[model samples]
Target chain A: MTGVIVTTINLTAIYALVALGISLTWSGLGFLNLSTGAMYAGAAYGAWLVATNISSNVVVVLLGGVIVGAALGALICLTVFLPLDGKPNWELRTLTATLALSFVGTNIYLWQFGPQFKQFDPLFDFIREFRIGETLVQPSKTGTVIATGILIAIILAFISYSRIGLGVRALTQSVEGAALVGINRRTTAFAILGVSGAFIGLAAVLLGQIYFVEPNSGYSPMIKGLIVALLGGLGSLRGAVIAAFLVAFAEAVTLQYLGGSWVLITLFVLIAVVLIIRPRGIAGVLEGTRA
Target chain B: MPRGREDLLHYAGLAALFVLALAVPFAFGTLSILGSMGVFLLLLSWSISWRRQGGDTLAGVRDRSAWLFWGMAGVIAILIPIIAGTSYFLAVMVTFLIYLSWNVMWGLVLGTAGLQSFATVAVAGISAYVAGYLSVELGKSGNLACVGGGERILGVPVFQWWVAIPVAVLVGLIVGFIISLPAIRLRGIYFALLTIGLVELARAYVVQDKCNFGGGQGLYGASSFIPESIAGDLAGYQLAYVAAAGLAALALIIYWRVNYGRLGLLLRTARESEPVAEVLGTDIVRARLWVFLISSAVLGGAGGFYIAYYGSISPSFFNFSTVLFLFSMIMIGGINSPRGILVGTMLLMYVDKRFVDVDPPEARYVFIGLLLFVVTIVARDGLISIPDQIRRRRGVQGRGTNPEGDPPEDVGAIEQEAHMPPGSRPEPS
Candidate 1:
């Protein structure tokens, strides 16, 4: 039971890492970035490239994810967003464009990395055997959960407090005001998109180690992240993180108790019921997004 | 302002095209003439409706004015096959008519109202499941129960022929109203997401019960509820289809007529500024509901017709991608344009269906994503609008006007007032 609990925590934390990044981009850019799925699959492949062909240092693999993901994210923002200049129909354009790009990215990665699954090593097995009163827990996944959640929360708080964070908030408020206040809209928007992409990359690397890395690995997480954000409240940073772990934990529990297919139907129903009742989400935006 | 020879020529062109549509099956032996015609008519109708609305025009169309000439040319081109002894092509024309039936309603809800939705396909899916289930249950007993009513279903005889269509239509109204209840609260894409969620929900619901709807396993043989003995043979069903289509099309024309004048202006204005419409004594909610309910009836009517043709149902038929396709149909054809809806569906659906090699079902998704991407970028208004663009360019050239000079002066001033300098203003690249 303890071992299973550890794995669940690890999975939930890993999901939060990806969901946090996705929610930030959505709040800033005003659409779910479908490309994160591709970037994730790319990261797993990237890890494989380093692990097999070069040095497999844990830090090195993660850095590879960040580099590849950031470059791709930056490139897409320039190509798709800048040219369009953030058109009014962000929901449609971003969804459609990123969706197409995801396909191309997936195909290219599939060709490069091949279609089968590949295994990679985790940072460490820290949940081995810990005695607490009358019980001892030995699970490799427990450490991952505690460590990942702490790391993500810290990163998010740091960014939110930073000057760039202030600029992002201002940009979201009124694009014109931000520029007038001497915030570089282009650079600022790029930073938000990039940082979000980087987080997704990190999550991808983590997932690759925990599970089998395949071409289609990112889609489930990507979709889960989107639902988490929406379920929490679109554009709420903290809500997405909290919702992420909640949903992950729910899925884990459902899988443990019920069946896999039932989880989707149940989650979908829960979301529909909530959204219909309160469009703002579980916690209203004003409550969640405070200065 | 005036209907002239050009307008006459346009209708004549439609007739000629209709005739040619009847003739095409003989020309291409492999082609299902009705399917081809259904697709073609869909495009034609889309073109007609979209052009009337001030929908988006890209690739230099920028709102071309000469709709009559294009309409006429379309007919003249189609007339050749009909004149060449291919009246049999009319059989294929019915298929295209069916497309128009559904899409027109979709244009009303999605296009005219500016209420973004993605649930029509799902509604169609639910109705399809309802339709197939009813037809199949009636069929299983080998009873002519579907043909009228010897067998009473809850003290009401099972409807056959035209009755089934209405039953389906009523169900559509129910589904539409159910979806509308949710749509009232949600904004644009949120409404769309809700629709998708409902569709998934419907998919789940449809797959569960064996008595009402055949599960994912699919419905077995279904009878065409149309009374063939009275109509004659297969050609008899054609008459019913055309008659039904004629009525539906006439209904659409009436819809268009209502929309063309003061009432339409009221709705259009309402879409841009609801408060203004409210100030002007328009019951915004009632007017919206009016259009919504009317559109639902038509959508339901279309679903009835589709079941008449397919004679089967499976939950698999309706999904997210179908919604995407419907969106593309309107977007590619023209927004808020009835004719454009028809033309766009035919042109895009045909091209997509033909060119797309969907050997694997998964590949179909990637194919559609790519298609939507390309079309969204190249012609956001849809393919039926292509001719309009060409015509506009021709007019611009006729005037000998020099294009591409000034950045609209008002844009800069507006940006400046918003506290963003012109340089820092959004790049209109």
Candidate 2:
């Protein structure tokens, strides 16, 4: 039972980190960026390459991941979003374009890194394991949980207080309203995307410590991010955080009782049920008009 | 040139293209680059001439010209197997036809209905699995002396392929209906994401259940629709080609009927503006449901054909990449054009087949992805609209109107207006 709780918490933290980016992008831009998974994977590979070749320091590796992910996010904004901004059918066009970029990024990963899995040197390996109520807990897992919690709190605070974050919030409410208020929509969009990308990059570093990273590693995490973001409501940061824990716990319990293979099947079924019951999601506000 | 002479030239061009398609297969091998290039050039020129004659419209001259073009295409399709004269080329042609069938079904939902569906592969997988399982079960019963040499279902002998096709379609309709129950609640990108989740769920269920689904090793030794006695060697390939082509023709006919009929109008109306469609008293739900059922049924039938041709089914065969490839083909060709589906499928499949020989196998994904991105950005209507886009860019005023005669509304503008707070609706673009 304790093992399950620990695992659930750890997963919830990591998933929340990933979901933050997805939620932010959706609310801020009204764009469903499907390339988050590719960004995650790219960040993982970037961190792995840096750790293996340059320095084993945790900070250096994490920074490398952040830079790579932010760059990717910015590049997408410039190449796809910037050119097609304010166009007719922008929503569908951007969605398809991001999906294409996702596939292309995965293929690039396959070409450069090959199909084999790579891992970062464990930063917390030397730390002693702790026992909580007869359950053995790895320090790395605990470290990740703590670190992710801090990151989420910081992001929440940043979004609440920062000027650019306020611009993002205004855009989320109404793009025209934001423009009327003199917010630079283009620059603000770029900044929000970069910050979201940095979150995904940080999540990637945390995830890479727990599992092997591969060309296809981004897909599963991307799916998880999507589910959490939808479950919490597209733009609700608090809801995403809460829903992340709920989903993580559900996944943990399912994994324990139903076995490993059934986890994804159950998750999908859960998502379908949620959509059926509450199309706007648990925390989503009604758009009050036909979408 | 006079209108009569221009029409005459269009018909002659189509005839020459048909003759070229017939001769190319025999002149060089089917896979030869020269043959492919020659056929591509001829088809392009023929289409341009047809378009120049305004064949897309319903005018009397264009109507006859449309018939002429389709008739020539039909003749070429019929001549392919005979001209190739080899099972290898026949097999390739069969693959192309099968993909075309898949795309035509997709075009109905994604193109006409404006639903971004990712469930085609999932539905196809279900159909193929059912057919393969039934064939294996019957084969087992026959070996046990429970039935005669002919295929038997529950101790009753029957034409297995005949049973398989309809059953697959029925299953597809049922599955499509069930998916739609949850699907119709979501809008836009959410709907597309839900389909992706559903697909992943189905794949997981298949992979995890080894006993029934054949697991990772997959099922084999299923009976083929073509009997060994009649289908000796190349004959089987020829039969597959003919069956697939027939199916493609049927799909095209269905596509034509839907696009030109009352159903097409309702679907397009709902797609463009659901609120307007509702105000007009259209039963949007019924229209969408019918689209789903028809599309799913066709996809299921194609799946049955797939199992018949390959004699096996596996989870890996219907993975995410397969769905993406199908989507890309439709998007690149022309989502709204039935003919565009054929052209897109052929072009992408050709690129895929040739890319197999490239040093790094994965590079093809990048190429395909880039193509999809570029096409989506440069030509919002896909490859079919490239000519129109060029004409517009060349300052051809009044030619910017879509062939369908509907003025292109700014989708973003409408969405923004809809979501804008009361008293703040933007002025209509």
In terms of DockQ, which candidate is strongest? 2
For model 2, the docking class works out as medium
Provide the overall lDDT of each model, using Cα atoms, as 2-decimal numbers.
0.61, 0.76
Best by lDDT: 2
Q: Give the TM-scores of the predictions, in the order they appear.
A: 0.73, 0.89
Q: Write the per-residue lDDT of candidate 1 for residues A106-219, one digit (tens) a residue.
A: 756666666788888655553466764554544435445655665567566757798887888887666667878999877877887777777787788777776788877887
List, residue by residue over B89-145, the lDDT tens digit for candidate 2.
788788888889889988888877788888888887788787767766665521122
Name every residue pair that clashes in candidate 2. Answer: none
Total clashing residue pairs per candidate? Answer: 29, 0
lDDT of each residue in B85-201, candidate 1, tens digit only: 232333334554565566666776665566666667776666656665566565343222233324667764464435667777888889888777757666655675566667667
- Candidate 1 chain B: minimum summed lDDT over ten consecutive residues — where? B404-413
Model 1's chain A TM-score stands at 0.86
* Poorly placed runs, candidate 2 (over 4 Å): A126-128, A288-291, B4-29, B32-69, B141-159, B230-232, B390-406, B409-429
Q: Tell me how each candidate scores on DockQ against the true complex.
A: 0.24, 0.56
